[model samples]
Target: MLSSGVLAGSASVQGPQGEVAQFEYSGSMLRINAAQNDGYALLRDGHFYTVGYNNGQPMVFDAGAMLKGFGDMAPQAIHGDLGAEIASLKDTGENEVVAGIQGDVYEVQFIDDSGAQRSESLVLSTDKRAQELRDALFQMMNFAESMTPGQEKAKAQSQDIRARLSSLNAGILRYGSEVTVTEISGEPVAAQRFELPAQPLDLQGLGKLFGQ
Candidate 1:
C-alpha cells in the first residue's frame, strides 16, 4: 500500500501508433497535480476558460465565460447514440500482463461521427497496489467534478465510470492519446501546485513551445 501524499509518474504512449505519436511530447504529457479542484485549459483559441475550477455555476471572469465544452479532453463517451454506442462495445475478456501487473483488456467497436468504425484498447488494473492508486486518482477526479458549476450531469457521467469500474472489477488507467498513469509515488507537493498557472500562454505560444 502507498501513502496518500502525492502520486506522480509519467507514461509515454505504448502500441505501434502510440510510439510514433509519443515522440512529439517532452516531460509528462499529463499531470494530476491538482488536489482539490479541476485543472484549467484554453478552449482551442476561445476567449474563456472552458475547463477549470468550476463550482456548480457559471465561473465567468474577465477572460470569458467558462462554458463547459465537455471538460476539455475527457475520455468517457458522451451523447449522440449513447444507447447504440454502448451496444456496439465488445469485451474480448482478454487479459494481459505488463511489467508484472495483470490487467483486463477491452476494445470499443463504434462507428465514428464520420461513419468510420474505430476500435481502441484500454487496460484496467487488477493489481492490489495499482487498485489503490486508481482509487486515489479517482478521488482527485471527483474533487474536480464536485467543484463544477451545477455538476449534476457531469457527476452522473463520473458515477457511471465509477460504477462500471467496480461492477467490472476494474478501473481505467489509460485512454487513447491523453491519459496513461502507470507508477505512483508518495512525494509531498506544495498546496500551491494545485492552483492554476499564474500566466497561461495562448494557443499560439503553446504551438511554438511544442515545436508544432
Candidate 2:
C-alpha cells in the first residue's frame, strides 16, 4: 500500500517495471511524478487527479471520479482495525543512529500470516524538538487518514493512533516502507496545490479515454 506515498521522494529504477517516480506534498496533497507521464495526485479533500502531456499541453482531472467510474475495477481497498491489528507495543530499550541522530528503539508487535507474533523496530529521537516534529506530523496524518470510510470505527481507531503518537514522542524519520523523512521544515504549503489545474472532463462520455 502506498498509503504513505506522499513523503517518499524521487526514485529511479531500471528493470522490466523500470520508471522514475517522484513525490511532492504538503499535509493535504501527494503527487507521484512518474515516467511516461507527468504523474497523478491524490488529495484527502475528496479529489484525485492525473497529469499527462498532449503535445506538452497539461491535463489534470478528478481521478477519484475516474476511479469511481471503474466500478469493480477500482483498486481493492486495504483496511484494518488498528486496535485488533496490533498485539502490543514492546520497548526494546535499544538505541540506533539514523542520519546522525541517536534515538531509542521500539517495536510494533503484530501477528504474521502464519499467526505467529513478530515485531519491527522503530527508532524515535529523545530530543524535544524531534518529539514535536513527530507530534505535528502525526496529528495531521491522523486526521487525514481518518477521512477514509468507516466513520464511527474510524473515530474510535483515530483515538488510539493519537495516543500512540503521543507516546512515541518523536517524528518518525522512518516507518514500514517509508523511504525517507527529514526534519520538519515548518514551511507553509499552498492550498491551491489540491485544486484541479483545468476544468475536468466528465467521465460520462470519456470511458474510452481511460479504457473503462
Candidate number of the best TM-score = 2
Query: Which run of 10 residues does model 2 get worst, by summed lDDT?
Result: 8-17
Number of backbone clashes in candidate 2: 2
* Per-residue C-alpha lDDT of model 1 across residues 142-179, encoded as one tens digit per residue: 43453233535445545655555566555555554444
**lDDT tens digits by residue: candidate 2, 35-140:** 5665565454645566665887767665555444443333223223232245676668888765456777767775543568766566666554444444434433
Which 10 residues in a row give candidate 1 its minimum summed lDDT?
A: 20-29
Colliding pairs, model 2: 48-63, 134-171
Model 1: residues with Cα > 4 Å off, grouped in runs? 1-90, 108-119, 184-212
For candidate 2, the lDDT comes to: 0.48
Show how many residue pairs clash in every candidate, following the order shown: 6, 2
- The estimated TM-scores of all candidates read 0.44, 0.54
lDDT of 1 at 100: 51
Residue 160 Cα positional deviation in candidate 1, in Å, after optimal superposition: 0.3
Each candidate's lDDT (Cα)?
0.41, 0.48
